[model samples]
Target: MDSKTGAAGGAKSGPRVRFAPSPTGYLHVGGARTALFNWFFARHEGGTMILRIEDTDAERNKPELVEGILEGLRWLGIEWDEGPYHQSERTELYRAAAQKCLDNGSAYLCYCAAERYAGGDHAEEEGAGGKVRRVVRCACRDGKPTSAEGQPGVRFKVPLGGTTRFQDAVFGAREFSNEEIEDFVLLRSPRGEETAGQPTYQLAAVVDDIAMRITHVIRGADHISNTPKQVLLYGALGAEPPVFAHLPLILGADRTRLSKRHGATSVTSYRDEGFLPEAFRNFLALLGWSAGGDQEFLRTSELIGKFSLEHVLRTNGVFDRAKLEWFNTQYLQKLPIEELLPEVEAELKRSKLWKEEWASGAGHEWFAKTVDLLRPRVRLLPDFSSWSRAFFSDEFSYNEAAREKFWKKEPRLPEFLGQLAGALEALAEWNHDACEHALRGVAEAAGVKAGVLINATRVAIVGEAVAPPLFESMLALGRERVTGRLRAALPAVQESCKA
Candidate 1:
């Protein structure tokens, strides 16, 4: 289809779209989701996805924020084909377009001063439905200036009569009357001069889309209000507007628009919080579009094949924290033990649980085994350090609740655990089988069920009531550390039992 005309006339290739983000701060989740949708659409249609930085407002655009947006995109696995064109670099294009609009009588100069909006002075002017007008069109439509104080600002002359309509890819047909969209500003200057802030978003966006030959525009639904104005600009420039796909707004649990109060708005925060990139991408995919049926966990490649603009939900998608964690857990479960080891080791080192000896020989094998044993219980990468505490360090703390329930419930638990430790230490083989046998032997001698001794040993060796498995956890901790922790924990158990 021809991007300019929105007609089916193209035979060269597929749609071309761009993910334009303002570098005001870190790439928020809403922006990231928009990028993902655009990426998936481009990939699915065999088109191009361009990264455009809408940093036209130099005063508000921070140089440091560009890197964060790029990092967030890279982390989310959303790559682009063309330039990360910054609007700051394209001032000439916007200036030329504004001049074209002015020469064609589609735009005029406005001499409205800032002081005119002071207090209730401007409220007397009535608008539609006899309400106080917020936007007052300038009386300079005849190419003449009213005030000689300073240069006037340029405003796009909204064509009189009729309604502007477009077929939205996601939301279907949308219409806006010319009366509803007043003569909005194309350039902001106190005097009638082309200066900085001359090209507003509507003008700059239309100019960039035409220059880049973008065939599709997939953005948040909030931009729906800006679409008609942009379409009018395109018509004024004698260029066709691109196909518009306004995605549903993402909302918080409270059903309001997602924001900082919604928690961790930036995509990098999720990256920093141990969320796997693939998992996050999957989560983002599900935010607005679905693959149909009960299929939730999907790879990026799979999503590309299944993603369709038609399937995008019209209602606002709720950002569910539990659902995202579920995706993270699923992704973590698919990772191999070796892949998880380095991260686990690094976390261990950071928490002072890492022993230099574990980097080589049998210690390395033990570390890998420990990670494998603990992987089943992990939800995030950081959980390796917290959940596998007893595996990497001998000085890890015991769970007070476990100490109370498992150790204190049986007054003779400390005595039994001490005997079980000696039995475990005396074993020639310190594997899972031998560990289970030793515990059962001790339990038989003490006239208690094997489960009772197992629970006590779990509290002693792993310092928690919940771990992977009894025999496997003990085997991963090794017999020496197991017996040592048992001896160390006996006094704490005795004290807790007395309490």
Candidate 2:
């Protein structure tokens, strides 16, 4: 969909953006995608991207989780150009903005009990005359700020009669009525064991956006409802609102909003499960956005060059995990051997499948060749270790299904393996063509088709029915292991791997 019908549009140049996430948990996929979009917009326009931590909720904020979130962004190659400005550290900014609202009569003091608005931010309550409203405003309209002892929380005032409207880049023109809007809490006064008052999310976010001079706000569509409130806050502070582009929500394959039942939602979960960062970034970029055409694969450089809010999808993106795996598979096959090497190495090391021999020299040559042969067959980084575990170690199990299919079908497997192993051991120079010649000769002597030996040899060599080409696989696994595994799989020689 190339429709840019109502795009509020891009900044002139050097637009500032921010990816503000609260440090409550790991950076989920949706949050990661938002960060990616903001990052793409910033990089596309050569602008500054600020990382802001909205950690004002002291009781729920985990200091340890902040680093995890940062790590996730870094892992996705979403490096910020500015400080991961913590909202808690910037209370002066929010407090000052709240006071300006109070001084200007845009805000008021609520002498009501703290329990009056107990549900916290975005919580609605019944107003006068049994009417329901999004917030509880002070009856007297006493404009003031939070105090330490006789603490009465502050709230921004909503205009009695008017509608707040702003243009969205993806979803088009949107409006929220002032009468329907809530005079939500601006600063919550601390009680029991506490120090300073905390600015509500609306105040802190608006204040920071204004202070940071952010020109564009590219975030998830879930925050669309919060925008009108923030717009009011910006107007109260006499600041211009940024260009808002609320990205469509990412849903699961079932078309439901993404959640745990849909699969692992965190970015690190994919990272830990062997996803390539470039591939993952490429996949994340396509969710709720497009560079156009049948081209699914986009490099980071390509994405930065092509990314525009005009192409941002109005429809919610479906998080097709199978499609993501397909993307990972393509990268595994197409990326340079050098680029895939370290990732495979790291994966192998993690799985305890790595060898000291793969470090350098002739052994390194063998390792490199093995990766080349295995790369096409690999889907994930762990596949480098799991799919081809036999390449790294002496001990690896044959697939049960492979054993039943290939081994059970060939009654002469022991004789055939013994014959093939003998033929292989007698090779002068070991390579694909030479190994092929040996196998064919063995099959001819056994008076059976090469397919029989090929099947047995495959399961014996790699312990998997499907693998890289048999001859090349023999070369990568080297002359010794191939012949050894074949001989070992023989019932007479060793019943350990007998079908």
Candidate 3:
């Protein structure tokens, strides 16, 4: 399985890479990172990036999973120049390769039963030092080639001795001794039927890569062990092997493999949780590769300009949620108001937090204003639901603690409200600046700090002390709702002051 002489040949005219994800489940974060790297490499070099769905495992593959992979890529803005070709559709190609290997004597039939192997014993045997080796010896290698009840089960004959070596773009040169790997099965069957037998991933992947003319194979480091087998397959088929680069694994904060226990692992989960695609892409790109210095955020084009296989680190990376959120905030703050408005509306509607009257009759300018007010404060879509609740509902639910602490206990509350209402009613302009000046005057007359009066007014009108800028919130709420909530809160304020 030695790497061919021309393997390290200079860069091809047009680099070609493929993101071949098995449609086994949702598009996981690890898979998304691989896709992003491939896409960046192809785009940077003005080459082609292909989307190939490895769906040969019928029992594991799902149609919805295929849709999920496409949706995830589209969400990340990772477009492919070539296919989303399905491996199942190309069975004829795999069959031809298997037949060629068989005809060339590179592969043969093995029908050994599971019990015939040396390690097949169920009972444990103790050695002289109480040590036992769970060794599995091949029955076919011993000249007693068993057949699968007269049905053929294909097996590749691995050449003995020597070593298989390849220079990995990220991990550098690596050599795997041939003695460590056993000659594995190429095709198998559940039943003793010809139609049931089919080629496994090892053979299918090699055939597909050759057929697709993939110039570079970029994938996770976990597949490093599978590379030699693939290289051997390429040699057996008389095909050239693609350049390989295995990315480091993404680990949890605990330095373990990422899983559901760590956090959201799938791309759709992040999208639903209000993560921006650009931010997600930026974060994934930096996981195993760095752009140097303290720079964290980069646009897709900027990422392409800086990306290279040599920059990718061989060490595993921890998927830090805080860093991801920080990146999301950067992208969120830069979002154009026009583009953010629809997302805000959609999130509100999806969460059933939007009022039909306000959303439909108020028009886009009003919505834009609301989004502008909330944009700087919002980190995620769900934040808008709670933060902007006062904007949607007419009746405000004043926090009991705030009412007791600020509004209810303040002396001369009625006089302050009466004076403030009179000043607001007499004003020609009811905008934020005018409202602020008028309320500040009332606070001065009452011998209280502006914030004190402002806090009370905020609770009276919006039902919460923590809200948008007090004056801006009041103007957006309109005069009717503002006066109504304040008037309703007056009696409660007066009663508490007396008590």
Best TM-score among the predictions, by candidate number:
2
- Score every model by TM-score: 0.89, 0.89, 0.87
Which pairs clash in the backbone of model 1? Answer: 4-240, 151-191, 151-192, 152-191, 152-192, 187-198
Give one digit per residue, the lDDT tens place, for model 3 in 1-499.
Answer: 1122122333445888999999856788999999999999998888778788887787746788799888888888899887777777776677778888888987766666454333322223576898974332355644456444655566777676788887688988878887655566677643544464676888888888887778899999999998988888899999888899999999999999888898788898998998888889999999999987677778877999989999999999999999998888877778777767667778879878775554555665677777787677778777777656777666457777777778755688878987887788878987888888999999898898888778888888877666788888887778777877777778777876787
Q: Rate the local accuracy (lDDT) of all candidates.
A: 0.81, 0.82, 0.79
User: In candidate 3, what residue range of length 10 has the lowest lDDT sum?
Assistant: 1-10
Residue range 1-499, candidate 1, lDDT tens digits: 1232232333438889999998856899999999999999999999888888887776646678799999999989898887687787777778788888999999987666564322322234676799776744555655444564566667888877789988799999999998777778887763335454457788888898988889999999999998998999999999988889999999999999999998888999997788888889999899988887799989889999999999999889899989999998887777666766676677677777888888889888877777777877888777777756777767678888887778766788889988988898799987878888888998898899998878888888888887988998876777788888889888888898888
lDDT of 2 by residue, 7-96 (tens): 123333598899999895689888999999999998888988888899988854677879889889888988887777787777777778
Q: Sorted by lDDT, highest first, which candidate order results? A: 2, 1, 3
Count of backbone collisions in candidate 3: 0
The lDDT, on a scale of 0 to 1, for candidate 1 is 0.81
lDDT of 2 at 88: 78
Candidate 1: 10-residue stretch with minimal lDDT: 1-10
